[model samples]
Target: MQKHTISAIICLAGALVAAAIAGASFLAMRKPDLIVRGPGVTDVKMLSDWFPGLKGTPGDTEVYILKGADDGASMLVLGGTHPNEPAGHIAAIMLIENAQPKSGTLYVIPRANASGFTANDPQEGAPQSFTIQTPNGPRVFRYGSRATNPIHQWPDPNVYIHASSGQTLSGSETRNLNRGYPGRPDGTLTERVCYGIVQLIKKENVTITVDLHEASPEYPVINAIVAHPKAMQLASDMVLGLEMQDIKISLEPSPVNLRGLTHRELGDFTDTLPVLMETANASQGRLRGRTDEALVLTGKDKWYVRAEKLGRLYVPYDEKGHPLEERVGRHVTAISELMNSWNLEHPEKPLEFEGLPGYEDFLTKGIGVFLLPLPAKN
Candidate 1:
């Protein structure tokens, strides 16, 4: 056989192998991650249950409901609004699997944008999934895209205009779930998801709505709580409570100009007090050195460390970098504090919950230990 012929055959074989590997990875990511029901979970509902327009679409997601012993005020917690932010997603999962309400209903959406988890962002080098070892065995979760998959919501326009306020933003944000709040029923898939969430809040009469998020270390909002004007007092008191516990979270009022965001639109359109919390994530920062699962979990990047030394980051960074557990700890603890503030302000319609471990629990026992085993199929 000719040498060129042999080279062509070898190249073809390599191409076929690469395609096979890629296909396998795509399938694995598409398979949904499992979340076992804990003592707190009373029932599970779907986003489509509230807004049927999202039915049979990727925008549909699970809603875990935990009703308290006594009928009282309600609260909604959104996690995985941005799938690239693993800490928020993990914290939401932890809440669903651990928290038990004592006085009111606790609603949690672990993957607010379910479509995002089916694909990873291009050129980011993020892992398809990461594993946490529990007592039973190992559990894995997806590390997904920041926006809805283009497969579900395609072809971005040159610019994104908020429907309610006519505010303009980069076209890519059209797929961002965070920017599609109080969404119109006839809008895009992301808007439909937003609509469903709004319906859930309205129908359930949720008193407090917390949108959990994670920002790059360099972003100005790291380690902060952003609240709408109506929710500012609750957030302020929560920040003080967090500070007393040495969590030290800053409070920022939601900007009126940011029309599409939850803090702005949700508060304007609904009675629910809207707030967003952000934790510093080194892996998502532009100054990060390597992009790998280790960076996602450990959050220790030499470049971010050096950037801190140069006074370039918003949050403090050091040799003891922000691990996944620490980031989740901050979110969980802050959430608990927020509930404390709400209960204090609304004594007649109190919101109280227990079984949520705080910062110290995460420090002592790793995140994996808190995760329950997946149920075996019959």
Candidate 2:
């Protein structure tokens, strides 16, 4: 064979092999992760059930309803709105797998941005997946992006304007599910997902809505709860209860000018009283040293510790670090307290749940114990 022909054949062979590997990886991402339905789960539905526009789309996600025998109010909990926040996602999973509603219905959307879970954000060097040691074995879960996957939503504008309020944000935020609340039915994939959630809240008559999230430790809102005006009283009572239990949490009013966020728009547009909670996560910070599974799970970072000593962080940091368990614990406990306060204020419309592990349980036993082992078929 000629020299050029020989080189061309070799290059073609290499290209074919690379394409095959890439195809396989893409297929793997398409396979949905496992989430074992706990005893409390009374029914499972799709987001499209509430908003049909999302049917057959990657934006569609599962909604787990845990209903109690007694009649009362309904509460909605959203997790994975930002796929990078492991604690938020895990807290929703834990509630699904462990909590038993006793008085009202508890609806959980653990993967609120399901498309985001299928991929990681580019340039973050984040792990594609992480493992938790369950009693049976190690259960794996994807670590995804903060925004909807670009594959599902394309071509952000130079600046994205909030449709409802006309407030503008960076174009990239158009993909943020939280920033698209009270969303349009025929909008971008992220907005459509937001629209579906709003429909669920309105249709279900959700009395209290809690959106779980996390921020970089350096962020001022770390370990805080942002409550809408109507929900402020309930949130304040819950904060007081959390403090009584030795769980310190700051309170922030949802900014009036924030156009598309859950606490702001959900409260304004829907009947549900919206409250959003944020926990500290060092690994998601810009100052994070090495982004990996260890950083995601262990939450120990010397850089963050030094920054804490320098008074650059909102939350206190030590060698012990803010492990995943602590962050998840904070979310779970705060959720319970919020429900408690809501129940007390609205006697006729109460939300109740049991079987959730308390702070000490999470601190000592860790979150892995609650995760179900991977299914044999999966």
Candidate 3:
């Protein structure tokens, strides 16, 4: 063969090999994670069930409903408002697998932003998934972007205007599920997911809605619960309940100026008392170093510890690190305590459940003990 022909063949072969590998990775990421349903899950429906508009879209996610033996009030719990915040997702899963409603119905949407899980955030050097060792074996899960994948909803405008309140924010926030509450029926995919959640709340008459989240350690809202004004009492009681157990969580009232948030829009648009809880997640923080699966699972970073010593962080940090166990534990406990506060305040219309792990159980045993090992393929 001529020299030019030989060179062309070599280049073409390399390009084809690269494309094959890229294709495999893309397909792998699109493949859904294996989430085994537990005994408590009585009905499993898609987000599209509430808002048909979400049908056939990546934004559609699973909604797990566990009904008590006796009828009572219903509560909705949301996880994965930001896919990078793994604790919220893990805590929601723990509730689905472990909790059994005692007096009311428990609704859990573990991956509230289902599209976000299909890809990692660009330029963050984050892993596609992480693993937790179970009693039987290892269970893996996706580590996704904080926003819906750009592939699903692309080309953000110069700025994002809140449809309901006209509040202006960075254009990229258009894909942040947390910023699209009481979502529009004909809006972006993220907005539609939010709309579906709102529809479910309105249709089911959800008494209390809890949105779980994680913030950077330096963020002021870390280790805090921000509740809508109508839900203030219940949140305050929840804080006290956590304090009694030495969990040390704070309470923040939702700001009136901020629109599109669950605490703000959900309360304004519906009867449900919306509350959001945030944990400290160093892995997603600006000060994080050596981003990897271990950092995602352990929440450990010398940089975070140094920043804490410099008096920069809002939450306590040490060589021991926050760890996924502590973060997930706080969220799960807060959820249980939130319901406890509701029962204490409204005995006649109480919300109660069982089998959720508390602080100590997660601290000593780790979240692995709570996860179910995936069944082997035949």
State the lDDT of candidate 2 residue by residue for 259-278, as single tens digits. Answer: 89999999999999899999
lDDT for residue 328 in candidate 3, whole number 0-100:
96
Question: Which residue segments of model 1 deviate by more than 4 Å?
Answer: 1-17
TM-score of each: 0.96, 0.97, 0.97
> Each candidate's root-mean-square deviation in Å?
1.9, 1.5, 1.4
List candidate 2 segments past 4 Å from native. Answer: none
Worst 10 residues of 1 by lDDT: 23-32
Local accuracy of candidate 1 as per-residue lDDT tens digits, 1-378: 999999999999999999999989887887888998889999999999999999999999999999998988898999999999999999999999999888999999999999999999999888888888889898999999999999899999999998888989999899999998889899999999999999999999989998989999999998999999999999999999988988878889898888888898889999999999999888778888878888889888889889999999999999888999999999999889988998888888888889999899998898998998889879
How well does model 3 score by local distance difference test? 0.91
**Local accuracy of candidate 3 as per-residue lDDT tens digits, 1-378:** 899999999999999999999878866887767777877889999989989999999999999999998778889999988999999999999998899887889999999999899888888989999999999898888988999989999999889998988999999999999999878999999899999999999999999999999999999998999999999999999999999998888889999998889999999999999999999888899999999999988888999999999999999999888899999999999998998999898899878788888899999999999987677899
lDDT of each: 0.91, 0.91, 0.91
Score candidate 1 by lDDT.
Answer: 0.91
| Total clashing pairs for each candidate | 0, 0, 0
Q: Once all C-alphas are superposed, what RMSD does model 1 give against the true structure?
A: 1.9
